[model samples]
Target chain A: MQLLNNRSAQLRAPGKRVSRARVAVVRAAKTADGPRVAIVGVTGAVGQEFLTVLKERNFPYSDLKLLASARSAGQKQEFEGHTYTVQELTENSFKDVDIALFSAGGSISKKFGPVAVKDGAIVVDNSSAYRMTEGVPLVIPEVNPEAMSHIKVGKGGAIIANPNCSTIIALMAVTPLHRLATVKRMCVSTYQAASGAGAAAMEELRQQTRDVLDGKPAQPKIFPLQYAFNLFSHNSGMDVELGYNEEEMKLVKETRKIWSFPSVRITATCVRVPVMRAHAESINLEFENDISEAAALEALAAFPGVSIINDRQNNRFPTPLDATTKDNVFVGRVRRDISRDDNKGLDLFVCGDQIKKGAALNAVQIAELLLK
Target chain B: MQLLNNRSAQLRAPGKRVSRARVAVVRAAKTADGPRVAIVGVTGAVGQEFLTVLKERNFPYSDLKLLASARSAGQKQEFEGHTYTVQELTENSFKDVDIALFSAGGSISKKFGPVAVKDGAIVVDNSSAYRMTEGVPLVIPEVNPEAMSHIKVGKGGAIIANPNCSTIIALMAVTPLHRLATVKRMCVSTYQAASGAGAAAMEELRQQTRDVLDGKPAQPKIFPLQYAFNLFSHNSGMDVELGYNEEEMKLVKETRKIWSFPSVRITATCVRVPVMRAHAESINLEFENDISEAAALEALAAFPGVSIINDRQNNRFPTPLDATTKDNVFVGRVRRDISRDDNKGLDLFVCGDQIKKGAALNAVQIAELLLK
Candidate 1:
C-alpha cells in the first residue's frame, strides 16, 4: 500500500525516472490453472490502471506480458511483485497468449487487434476502432453482458469492444431506470475530466494550474485552449455537416448500439472540466411508460455496480470527487421531470471514475464475463 | 484601462487592503440631466461589477451613492476619479436617488428594496426577492425590456427584478429561437462559476486552489465541498420533495415569468464549476413549430447583445473564458437536434459573464430602460 502511494506520487512528476524504492512488492500467486494474460499499451494511463484493477480484483493468471509502443518498449514496469520490461507491440507479441487487453489509441488497436485475435487470443479492446464495427460486441457488463456471451477464453479467437468512457458512465446510472420503463429519448451533458484525454493532459492541467497561480500565463499544449481554470467543448474532431463533435456523436451512436434499441433518440453536449479523473453527467430521460422517481431509485438500488447519493435534505449529492477511485457509479438528484405532466420523465446526476468504471474496471468485468 | 486591470488583480487577493494606486482616474463626465444612481451591497462581487459595467457603458449619472452592510461601511471605494466612503444601507439612503441597483442577498433586498422603492427611487433588484412577485417585472434586457416599460425616470416608484444568473444566460440564447418558434419544453445544464455565489465564495475557490496545489488539505469554508479542480451541484437550498435546488427551480419559474408564458415547460440542472466569472449552459429546446438551424442562427444573429461563435471547422464553441467580463452573451453549437425527427428541437451551447449580463449589467440595462 505504501509503495502504491509512492508510485502514485511519482506519476504526478512527469519525466522522472521510476526509482526502485517506489516499486510495489505485493505479488499475486501464480496458478497454472489460470489463463495467460497479455496487456497491450502497458505504459499509458488506462494501461497502468488495467494492471491495478486486475491485481485489486485478483484476476487469476498463470503468466502476464506487458506490451507498449517502441518508444516505451524498454521501460520497466513493476506489477504483481515482478519487474517486467515492456516489449514493443507487434504481430508476434500475442503468441500463445490466452486473453489480451488492449487500450492503446485507435490506430494501434486497428493495426494489432486482428493479429492478436488470429493468434488465438481473445481481444478485449478499449478503443473506438472496433466499438462501431458491425460484428464487434460493444459490451458494458452491467448493462449488457449478453452482447459478448459467445466469446470465451480458450474457446476461439474473438474481439469484444468497450464502449466510450462517457457512454459507459452514463449507461451505468440510466440503464437501471431504462430497464423499468423503455427510454424514448436521452439528453446528456457531460462535465468530463482531464484523464479522458490521457495522462499527459492531466499533467498539463496540473502544471498549467501551478503556473497560473504563480501569476504566469498558462501555456496550452495538449489542448487548444487554457485549461487551468476554464472548461470548453470537448476537443474532439468535428462532424461539420452534423454540427456535433465526435465526442458528442459517440454518446449518441454508442448508446443506441449498446442498448440494442436503434430507435431511442439521444443527444449530448460534451465539455471538459478541470477535474482530475472522474466524470459527472447531467441526464434527462423521457420514458415510453410511466417511471416515477421512487421506482427509478428502487431499480438503481437493486442494480449491481450502482450507488445512490440522492440526499435532497442535506443537498449532498455526488460530485466528481465522490466517485474518484471508486468502482461503482454514484447517482443522485433523482427526480421526476416537473416540466411534463406525466411521470414518464426523469432527471439524474451521475458521477463515475473515468479511469475505473469508465475504462479499466469495465473492461476487466468483461474479461470476468468471459471466464463465466 | 491600466487602472481597471490593477483593480482586477487586487480583487483576486481577498483580505488585502485596496491601494490608492489601483483607483481609476478616468471620470465619467457626470451630467446634471442624468439620473441619480445608488448601488446597494457595493462590496459584493456583482455590486463591484455594477461600477465597472456602468463606467464601460458610460451610463450618465449626476451623482453616485455606494451602500453596503454595516460590516463594509466606512470602507473607501474609488470610482470615476474620486474616492467615496461606502455607507451603511438605510431607509434614508434613497432620499434623492432616481435608480437604486440592489444586489445584496435576498434578506437584504427583501428588507431594503421596498424601503428604496417607497422612498421614490426605482429599484432594480438582482436577487430573487421580488422576481416572482405579482406585477414586478422579471426582466432580461434583451428578452423582455418592455416588461417594465410602464415605469420611467422621475415617475412614481416601481421595482423590476433581474432573473437568476443561469436563467439570464439561457434565455439570452433561447429567446431568439423561441421567437422564431414558440418553445414548448427546455432543458438546461449549467456550468456555473464561483462569482454566482458571491465575492467571498470566489475568494474561497482561489484559496482552496492554492492550498490544494501546495499539497495542503483544501479547507472548504464557503462551500461544503472542495472547490479546486472540482465541480459540484449548486449549493443553493434544495426542495426535498421536488428534488430541485433553488437555483434550478429559479431557472424554471423565472423563465416562465419572463416570457409571460406560464405554461412553457422548463427543467434545469445547475452545477458550479471552478470558473471565475462566466457561466455556460448546454440548452436543449423543443419548439411548438419547426425551426430550422439556419433560421435559428438568423434570429440569433439579429438579436441584440448576442454573439455567435459557431466555428464547426475548428470545433470552437462558446466557453466560459470567452465570455468573461464581456457585455454580450456568446452562443455556439447551433445545430438541429438529431434526436427529434422534426426541426422542432435544437441544441445550443451558451456562455455569458455571470456578473455582467447575468446580474449587474442586466440591472444596469434595466436602469437604462427607465430613462426611455
Candidate 2:
C-alpha cells in the first residue's frame, strides 16, 4: 500500500475534500402523519447509497423497512440508531409503505416498482425500468421537479423515474444555460466513472489497478477492456443501425423528454474512464440565441448543485477528484465555441458524483419533492 | 514499485504484447551523396524518438551529430555501434549539416531553425514555432506530403514544420474520410497523453503516482493539477478573447492550413489525461457528401498509416495502450452520427503515439519525402 497511489477520492472533490456531513441518528419518535419509507435493493451500491443519503439529509420517516434479494436477506443493516434485518423483497413488502426507493436492476424494478406503486406507495425508481415510458416522469429534482410535483405520498400511487446518471449530471449544468437561450443542438463527450457500472465495476477497477501495479495483467471480469490507466468507449450495447450505444441514446432522448422538446438536436460520444465515482463530461451546446461568456457563467453559477471552478489564469478546472463524494456538479472551462461565428455556441466541462447526485441523492431529492 | 500498476502495455493491444523490432545498428558505409544529419535537442523525448524512427526506417546518413544544451554537451550517446559525444548546439552547429531534425522547444527551433536553413541544411522542426507561419508548410507525411515536396537536401535550405500531435493524429484518421467525402465541419475532443508536454511531465506523472500511492501529496511541479488518475484541460495559455487554449487553436488552425481549406469549421477541446505516451481523440465530422460506415471503414483501412480497431461485437476499440510507440494511428468507433438526418455526419475514436507518428516518425517521414 505504501508503494502506490491507492487512495480513491470518491464523492470527495478536491479543494473541498473534507467530509463535514455525518450520518444523523433519528430515534423512533414518529407522528401519525409521517410517511412509512422502504428502501428496496438495500444491499447493492446505489441501494446502500439510499440509506446514507437519507441519513445525511435527515429525512424524516415514521417507519423504515430494508428489502433486498433473497441472497442478501437475513443480513443485518445498521442505519441511524436502529439495527434492521434485510427482508427479501416480495409483492407484500410495500403493503403500508408511503414511499419506496427502487435501485435494483431493471427487471427487479419492473417487477417490484409497479407493485410498490399499486400499494399506494410513491416509488422513486433509480432504474431504467420506468424512464422513457410515455407517462412516467423522468425527473432531476433541480432540473425538473415540477414534472413530478403533482404526485404526493399517501394521496395516490405513482412512479417517479430517475434519469440516467449521465443525463442527471449533464442536465444539472446545462439546464440553466438552456433556459437563458434554448439549446438548439448539443454535442457531448462523456468521461464516465466506474460507479456507473455498479459496485462490482468499481471494485474491478480498484483491484485491476492493484493488479496492474503489481505487474499483473488486468482481468476484465466486469468490463471487456482493461480499466486501469486506460479508457474506452462505453460498454453499453451499441445500436447497430444508428451507431449509437444505449448510453448515448439515453442522454439524447432523455434530455428531449425532460425538457419537453421533441426536435432538439443531440449527439454524444460516451467513454468510460478509470475514475472511481465521479463522471466528467465535455459538452458543446449551440443555442437558438446569442449567449456570451458572462451570461453563460452567470446562469451556471446560479443553478443549484452546480459549482464554478473555472480559474483560467491559473488553468485550474474540474477533475473527477474534485467531484468525488460531492453533491454539486463542478463546472469549468466555460467558454465560447470559437468555430461558430454566431455567438450561439458554448462549451463546458462538468464533473459530478454519478453515484451520489446522479443516483441516490437525486432520487432522495425527488422523494423530498413529494413532501412539498 | 511492487505495489502499483507500473507495467505499461505499450504494444499489448489485443494479442500483440511482445515488441519484435529491435533497434537497428547502422555503420557509416553510406554513399557520398547521403545526407549529414544533426539531431537538435537530442536529449529530449521526441529527440530520442527521432533517433529510433531514423534507425527503424533505415534512413541513410553519411554522418550523425547529436546536439543538446550546454549542460548535456559532453554526455555520451551510442547509435548503431557508434558512440558519439553530445555537442552543444550553437549557430555554427549546422555548418556542414545537410538535414537537421529539431525536437527542441519552440524558442530553440525558432532561433536555430532559421540558422540551419541559412547554413544550407533543411530543418524539419517538430515544434509549434513555425507551424502557423504564412509560408512554412505544416506537413503530416501521410496527409500532405506534397506541402513540402519542393524542399530537399543538397538544394537550397527550407524549414518544414510538423503539425501538432492532436492535429496529426486526427488528420491521419480524418483525411482519408475527408478525401472520400469533403469535411465541412469537425468537432474534436482529445484525451492527450503526458509525452506531448515533453519528458518531464511524463516523469512527473510517474513520480506523482508513486508519491500519491505512498500516501504523500502529489506535488504538482510540471502540471497545476494532480496527474495521478486525474485529467484537466490543456495547460497551454488560453486566448482570453476567444476562450480557447493555444493547443485547441492549433487543431483549429493547423487542420485548415494542412488541408488548405480555410472555410472548414473546426473546434477542439484538448484535455490532458493520465495515459503515459499515446493520445486518444473522439472526433465528430460533418461532410459535404454522404458516407456510410462501410465506406468510412474502407477509407480508414486503405490509408497508409491508419488502422481500424472497431469491433462492435467485442466492444473493442482503439485505446492509448494500443497506440503507444506505434507508427500507425489506430481508429475505431467508425459509425454514422445518429443525430444527423442525412448521411452528412460521422463519428470516430482515434489513438496515436504522439511522440512517434505525431512528432518524430512524422518529421522523419518528411526527411524521407525530401530524399525522394
Question: Which of the numbered candidates is closest to the native, going by highest lDDT?
Answer: 1
lDDT (Cα) of model 2? 0.86
Q: After TM-score superposition, what is the CA distance of residue B30 in candidate 1 from its true location, in Å?
A: 0.3
Local lDDT at B248 for model 2: 95
For candidate 1, the lDDT comes to 0.89
lDDT of 1 by residue, A134-156 (tens): 98999999899999987878878
Give lDDT: candidate 2, residue A214: 72
For candidate 2, write residues A1-372 as lDDT tens digits: 110111122223356333333221343223246678889989989999998888777787777788999999999886653467788999999887999999988999999888888889999999888899988999998888889878988788999899999999999999999999999989899888899999999889877876777789989998988888788899998876676888999999999999999899999999998778889899988999999999999999999899999888777789998998888899999998877888999989999998899999999999888987
Considering every candidate listed, which one attains the maximal DockQ?
1
Q: Which residue runs does candidate 1 get wrong by more than 4 Å?
A: A1-29, B1-28
Best by TM-score: 1
TM-score of chain A of each: 0.92, 0.92
Q: True-contact fraction for model 2?
A: 0.55
DockQ of 2: 0.50
What is the lDDT, from 0 to 100, of the residue A41 in candidate 2?
Answer: 87
